[model samples]
Target: MTSTAPAQEWPADVRTLAIDVGGSGFKAAILDPAGAMLTERVRVETPYPCPPERLMSSVVDLTQDLGHRDRVSVGFPGLVRNGKVRNIPSLSRTAYDGDTDPALEDAWRGFDLAGALTEAFGVPTKVANDADVQGCAVVSGEGFEFVMTLGTGVGTALFLDGRLLPHIEGGHAPFRKGDTFEEQLGNVARKQIGNERWARRVVEAITAYDRFLFFDTIHVGGGNAKHLDPADLPHKARIVANTAGIIGGVRLWDLDA
Candidate 1:
């Protein structure tokens, strides 16, 4: 559903809405296209089997009550190709997995999210993987950079040559001891090890990752990121807020084609 309509331009002063969708929760921000927060961020529980219609309606409802905006950017938790979910491998185990949840199944999968959002809001919308969009916000137009989001699951996204590469799915990639990296480094791992141990693991993981990618920089974000004390980290690494979703959403204006 990639649009051929004249590329929509975001108004200089118009506020834009940014959303980051996860399997367990959703976060939204109302801001200028530059990612500046204009209103307090809003979050809602993401019960699995949430029908796409219901989810969209919820967003519309929230925005309508919160106030309307000119653009909407969504960071979805799946492999989005041309604004459609090709495979939701990471989110497949959630409540909506089989579309078995009677309250909402048809609306979750096989829906043209960007298109539906446009129809719902009468404004342009752009969608991408949550981790990918988070990574996009980290790149500083210099060299390769990556982001590892430590939340319900670990998510990794790589940016190369300044353009965002879609659907990297680095979290599911196998790591040591027959476990996926996400399982080892994700929030699940934190719970297994407790906070103090989890922090140590994060340091070691980051050090190894730096060596593996030979990356110029690494950014750590997500809910758990705030818990990480900067003094505990090795070397100089940039730490950013999860709010990158808004800035990355603004980049959609540049991506419209």
Candidate 2:
């Protein structure tokens, strides 16, 4: 049965187990209700052939040292609908043939991630796209806001007047040369084309997205965000800590958030 700790008798400061599942690493930590980390975050390299079962096992192992938590939240690098993963490009063999194990792709598609985590940890669990979760941690909640995460792949999330909009897998949308945003700006692309060229691509992407969305503000995050120079970013954009992934997890349980 699903635990309803957050909606029931859980204390105001109840701890939350926050997991950030990325293409390159799986990280976890304990956070207080206010979204502050209560323990040192731990990370492990994402296992190759990272199907649901293997990913769950790694998450459990990584958080073994963190103390008790009332609930769990996960920020996944994929399309999540009602806690199930619909598409995980970085893990899909069809999308990254050389890096992924083809045999495991189907297992990741349509995986019930929240159900599995609730069963394993015996706590209420919520799952959402990594960028959506990060947006929760930093959005001003005043007007139209956008978030872009630059990591193993690009991720985007939109909010208007503080409410999340229906998710759009814009990262997979074509950006240049008939290639998806991930193909042009993802980590592999940066390595293949060099930082200067990658930075240029990022600038071009920002310009294009501005014209398309016209958001009041855009928060840029993820591991690769650090590689960008502040001066190179647009006036409407600002860099946020990668830790927003972990911190934002708590907001998943906020009914009004």
Candidate 3:
């Protein structure tokens, strides 16, 4: 199919909710299909012993507060196939780090997240990987695009032909022999280098990533993107912030089509 650029105006009648779920926190916003934020984005710390029931309940509480949004989009940190989380280890490190919480089980290994949200909210829900959704917000399919997010852990997602594919754990991808990219460039790296030094190193890292991937554009976003200084960047890349949920939510249809 020939791809069109994202619309400047969103469909007016559809009200949608977009949620970002991470290892540590959750961020969400209610928006009109036109991509206008209708309510302030709300965030809460993700519960430590994240049983699926509890996680699902947190979402219910958030939507109930919104009252009547008709559509919902959720961004999960793990590998999502047909709205089901296939790998918890990639999404929640604490759950898989061999510190098995009594509350979790293998049954949750691949649960239908879309159906759960639909059942709870009484509205159709579309779910995609958090990194993939973030990539949708910043990359418009103009060329080869790679997005890197530095948050609780490093996240990587790619966008091609105006479509958001499944996320890649580039952070978990091996970097120097045995160490993963996340270990090198993730926020944990912040402790080793102060913000300024980290920014400089980010510049170097992005330059290397660009050259390696031959990417025409590199888009960076995440909780930590705000802490970076554009002046220290090494290449010509767009620094995007503030509108990640809005732009990313617009691509929620990818879950079905």
Report the number of clashing residue pairs per model. 1, 0, 1
| Candidate 1 structure lDDT | 0.70
In terms of lDDT, model 3 sits at: 0.68
- Report how far residue 9 has shifted in candidate 1, in Å: 3.3
lDDT against the true structure, per candidate, is 0.70, 0.85, 0.68
- Assess the local accuracy of residue 81 in candidate 3 as a C-alpha lDDT between 0 and 100: 74
Q: Give per-model TM-scores.
A: 0.84, 0.93, 0.84
lDDT string, candidate 2, 99-194, tens digits = 665566678877788888888888888888899989989898899999999999999999998888878988888788999888899999999989
lDDT of model 3, residue 36:
71
- Displacement of residue 22 (Cα, Å) in model 3 is 2.0
Better of 2 and 3 by TM-score: 2
Model 2: lDDT of residue 237: 86
Model 1: lowest-lDDT 10 consecutive positions = 96-105
Error of 1 at 123 (Å): 1.2
